[model samples]
Target: MLTKRIIPCLDIKNGRTVKGVNFVDLRDAGDPVVLAKQYAELGADELVFLDIAATLENRKTMHKMVLQVAEQVNIPFTVGGGISSVEDVDALLHCGADKVSINSSAVKRPDLINELSDKFGSQCIVVAIDAKQVEGEWLVHLAGGTIPTKINLFDWAIEVEQRGAGEILFTSMDHDGTKAGFANQALAKLSDIVNIPIIASGGAGTIQHFSDTFIEGKADAALAASVFHFGEIPIAELKKELKQQEIPVRI
Candidate 1:
């Protein structure tokens, strides 16, 4: 079995690492470069740097900040937000990102996924979906979870794979920063429907949550922010707990 990955997410705003609940009430966390280096040293499987407000602000992700953070980590780094075209992906790759994640832009122009995959290979493309459950349906959201789309989460996941996305990073807006647990039922549904690997994000609170995300959510990787950022959970201890639970993980 493939080892389940534990990824620490750094949500950047104004070039500073931040954390929030339900994607609001933001608070300062720390420096992105410092956090990146720390997570890499602590044995994170991968690092995700998301410029959370880039799309909503109508600007590109901070290249200088990405470069600074990239310099601090050797792990497979995925950078996202305001990434719209092939040139943007190329620029980020040149800036040292191992993978580029696309969300709102991909929703606006679905062909951007194909373009990115064609240029950088599917393995380098990560399609991130910010979804919220409304009226008993998981609906995809854009512009940093502010704009709702008609796209269904399951349908978009399959479509992204068909369009050649290497992976799907699904963030549950309903669960974001709740510390309750991941949306395992939704994740399981996605796993059953899509062939591509899925990265489960949002609502990771305890060590058991990580294990559950792997065992019940059927996620290839589990990504969290506040818990890791605030030291509520340490990566090494979390991995150890997951290993003890018989979940295959790098220790």
Candidate 2:
């Protein structure tokens, strides 16, 4: 098995990093560049910069800020938010992002995943799915997860893989900011169906949550916000704990 990666997520809103519970009540966490540098120094395998409200608000991603953060960090970083087209992906890559994640746009234009994969290769296409469990259904959401679609999460994930997406960044909007634990059940199903890597996000409150995400959720990488954002879990120490638990990880 490949080593499980511990990734720190930076949710940028208006060029500032923020964290919230259940996707509401967002509060400032730190400056994006500073937080990215800190996570890089803490031994994070990778970092994800999400312009959380970019797509929802009908504007492009904050590129200038992304450029600043990318130049300051050493590890591979992924950028998302309002990335609706190949031009957006190209611009972000030129700005220093190692990978580009697509969320709402992919849901509305599933063909974009295939197009990007063909143009940039599957490795560069990360289909970031924001899902919520409502009435016993895992529904896909759009526009920073403020809108729900009729698409089922499992079905959509399969389509994304078939369309040539290299990976999936599955964030559980229901568990987001809950900090109780990850949505392991959703992850387990996704991991079972998709051969590509899955980055589990949301509800990561403690060290054990990371372990559970890998072991129980069967995720290849675990991404969290507040715990790492507020100094609740040191990235290096968390990776150390995962190693001790025999989860393949880079320390």
Candidate 3:
């Protein structure tokens, strides 16, 4: 079986790491480079650095910060936010991002997924869908979860896959920062619908949540922020516990 991955997400703003609940009321987490190194040393299988305000601010990802963070970690890392064109993708990848995640821009121009995948190869492209459950249907959100769209989450995931996205990083806006658990139901449904790897984000609070996301949610990877950011759960401890529970993870 393919080993499931544990990833730590660093939501970046102004060169610092920040995270918010339901994508609002942001609070400082720490310096991005510092956190990246810490997570890498803690056995994080991968790391995600999202320039949470890049799109809203109408600027590109902080490439200087990305290069600094990239220097500290050995694991594969992904960078997202304010990425709209192949030039943007090329810039980030040149700065050492193994993959570039596109969200708002991808929704606005679905062909961007195709363009990126074609240029960088599918393995270098990730489509991040920030979604919220409304009236029983998951709706896509953009610009750091502040804008809503008509695109349904499941449908979007399928489209992204067909367009050649190597992975889908699905974040439940409703469950983000809740720390209750992952949106496993939606994750499982996505896993069944898409052929590419599915990464579940949001609502990760406990070790059991990690196991559930992999086993029950049927996710190939689970990404979290605050819980891992605040030292509420150590990556080493979480992996050990997950292994005990029979979840295949790099130890």
Best by TM-score: 3
**Model 2 clashing residue pairs (backbone):** 21-177, 22-176
List TM-scores for all candidates, in order.
0.91, 0.90, 0.91
Report clash pairs, candidate 1: none
Writing each residue's lDDT as its tens digit, candidate 1 over 1-251 gives: 67999998887887777664222122323667766776788889999888877753423347777777677677888988778889888988988889999998899999999999988899999999999998999999988788999899998999999999999999999998799999999999999999989999999999998888888999999999878777788888998888887889887
Global fold similarity of model 1 (TM-score): 0.91
Q: Per-residue alpha-carbon lDDT of model 3 for 96-206, expressed as tens digits?
A: 889999998899999999999999999989999999988999999987788989899999999999999999999999888798899999999999988899999999999
lDDT of 2 by residue, 1-251 (tens): 67999988877888777764222122433567776776677788998887867754423447877688777778898888778898888888878788999988888888999899999899988999999988999999987679989999999999999999999999999989899899999999999998999999989999999999999999999998778766788777888888899988876
- Quantify how close model 1 is to the true structure by its C-alpha RMSD in Å: 3.9
lDDT scores in order: 0.86, 0.84, 0.86
Off by over 4 Å in 2: 19-29, 55-61
Q: Which stretches of candidate 1 lie over 4 Å from their true place?
A: 20-29, 55-61
Better of 1 and 2 by lDDT: 1
Model 3 scores a C-alpha lDDT of 0.86
Location of the lowest summed lDDT over 10 successive residues in candidate 2: 20-29
